[model samples]
Target: MTTSTGQPLAAQRILVTGGAGTIGSHVVDLLLEADAAEVVVLDNFARGRMENLAEAEAVGGDRLTVVTGDINDPALVRDVISGIDVVFHLAALRITQCAEQPRLALESLVDGTFTVIEAAVAADVKKVITSSSASVYGLAESFPTTERHHPYNNDTFYGAAKAFNEGMLRSFHAMNGLDYVALRYFNVYGPRMDTHGLYTEVLIRWMERISRGEAPLIFGDGAATMDFVHVRDIARANLLAARADVTDTVYNIATSTETSLKGLADALLAVMDSDLKAVHGPERAVNGVTRRLADISAAARDLGWTPEIGLSDGLDDLVTWWRHAAQPAVAG
Candidate 1:
C-alpha cells in the first residue's frame, strides 16, 4: 500500500519494538496488510503479550518475526535492527510505573530509547517513528494543545523522559542525518488497552461495576477532561508517519474532541443501557492535569491522517471485546 504522497510500503522492511503491545500489535497487522517485505517485532513481554500478535502471526506467515527480548540490550537491539528499513520504537514504561519506579523508567525510556536510535542510525534505516505522550503537556497553558506548545508545565518523570527522547531524536537527526518522527499520543483506549494502568483503569473499573449493577465511582466533581483517541487510529497515525515524506518533527495524534470524566461515564452508561448514576468520591490528591485537548491539524496536514472512530463507537467496540474475551491479567 502507498501513502497519499505515493510512498510505497510494499517492499519495506520494518521493525516494531514492543510490537506485541496494544498499539504496536495493530501496527504490525497494518504493516503486513500493506504488504511489507518483512516485519520484525522485538519485545520483552513485560507489558506486551504474545496473544496480541496472534492475528498478525496468522496473516503474516513467514513475513513476520517475533523476538522475545529487551530493547535496552544493545547487542540484541543492534542485531534486530540490522537490515531493517524503518523502526517503530514503541517500548516504554507507563506513567504510573515511571512514578513508582523512577530508576527503571530512566533505564527503559532513556537508555532503551538511546539503544534503538543508535541501532537505527547504524543500520542507516530510512526513518524511526517513536511514541511520545500527552503527559508532556501536563497542564496545558492553552485549551487545544498544539505541537509547538512548550512542555514547561510537565513535572512527571514519564513526561520528562519522553521530552528527553524527542530531543535526543532531534540531536541524532542533526548530527547523523537520521530521519525521525515523534508521535504525541493522547488517551488511547481500545480492545487491548492496559486494564491496570492508572489512566485507563477507569474504563475497566467502571464497566466491571456496571456489570455488577453498581454505580460507577467518580473522583472529584467529574470535571477532569481528556482527549481519548482509539488505538486503531493511533496505529494508523504511526503508519502514516512512516509513509509521509516529513521528518525530524513531532505531531499530535488525537481527536481534538475533549470529554470530561462525567461525560465519559454518561456515554458508557448509555452504551451499556445502565440506569446506575456515577457516584462522586472525594477529590483526587494528584489529579495531575485537569484538562486535555489536542490540536491535530498538523497531523492531518502533513501525514494525511485523522481519527476515524468516534468516542461512542470506540467505547462500544471496547465493551464488546471485553464481553467476549477473557478478563485481561493485570499489567505489571
Candidate 2:
C-alpha cells in the first residue's frame, strides 16, 4: 500500500490503542494502506465492536492484528508496546459520557494514559501520537481556537483528564526523551462510527434518526458551532505525525473552520436527501460548545498535514456507507 504522497510505510510496526473505534479504525486503515509492516489494533471493546476490527483486517489482510486489551493494564500495555515502533493512543471515554461517569473516564483517560506512557518509556518505543480533545479548550475565549489556549477551565472532567494526559506526555518527552505528539482533535466523524446508543457521535445519531423516519433533535437553538473534520483526514495526520519532525510538543489536528449545529443538520439532510425537520430539544445536562475552529498553521508547518476533504464531500461518502451499513452484514 502507498500513502497519498506515494511513500511506503512497510518498515514501521504500528499499534493503535483504540484501533477498533470510529477514529482509531480509520487510523488503522490509513496505517495499513500506507504499507505498514504490522498494524496492531489494541482495544477493550467497551465502545468499539469486533466488526470494525474485522473490516480493517479484511481490507489489509495479513498486515493487521487485533489485540483485545485495556490501556489501563500496565503489564498488557507494556507487552503490546515492547515490539512496536509507533503508538497511536486514541482510547478515552466520550465527553458527555465522561460527564456522567467521571471516575471511569479518569481511570481510562488519566491512569490508563500514564500506563501507556510508562510502558512506552520502558519499551523504548520510537514515537507516540495521542488524541486530545478540543473540549480541552472549553468555552473558547476567542473564535478559531489555537493550541495556545490555557488548560481546560473548570469544565467537564473529560476535558480535564485529556489536559492532564497531554501534560504528562509532554513531561515524559522532555524528561525521559519519549518522542510524542498530542493531537488536539476537534469534532471527528466518518463511517464505522457508532450510531445506535448513547455513545454515538452527533452526525451519526442525526443520520440514524433520519434513517428511522424520525426527526432528529436539536439542542441549544442549533446555533452552537463545532469543528467537524473527517476521520480520514485525522488518519492521514496520525500517519504524518508518526514520521513528522517533532521538536514541538503538540499540534492541533483540525481545519481552521467552524460548523454550527444547524449547518450540520442542513448538510446531513441534503446528503441524505431528506426533508425531515429537526425538533428543538431541551438542553440536556451536557454543556454545549459555543465555537470550535482549530489553528492548523502549526499542524501544517510541523506535521506537513492538513485536511483536504471538506464536510460536504466527506458526508457524501459517510452517508453512503451508513445507508449500506444499515443492511445485514456480509460474511467476511
Count the clashes in each prediction: 0, 0
Q: Which stretches of candidate 1 lie over 4 Å from their true place?
A: 1-7, 196-200, 328-332
The stretch of ten residues in a row with the least summed lDDT in candidate 2 is 1-10
**lDDT (tens digit, per residue) of candidate 2 on 1-332:** 72221223567888899998888998887887777889888899888887676667788888888889999999899888888888899988888788888888888889999999999889888888899888788888876667887864538888888889888987997899788888988888887777664666677777767877777778768888888898889888888887776733778887787888988898888888888888888876567567787888988987789899999999998898888774422211
Q: Write the per-residue lDDT of candidate 1 for residues 268-300, one digit (tens) a residue.
A: 999899998999999877647999999999999
| Reference-based TM-score of each model | 0.95, 0.92
Best by lDDT: 1
Pairs that collide in candidate 2 are none
Shift of residue 108 alpha carbon in model 1, Å: 0.1
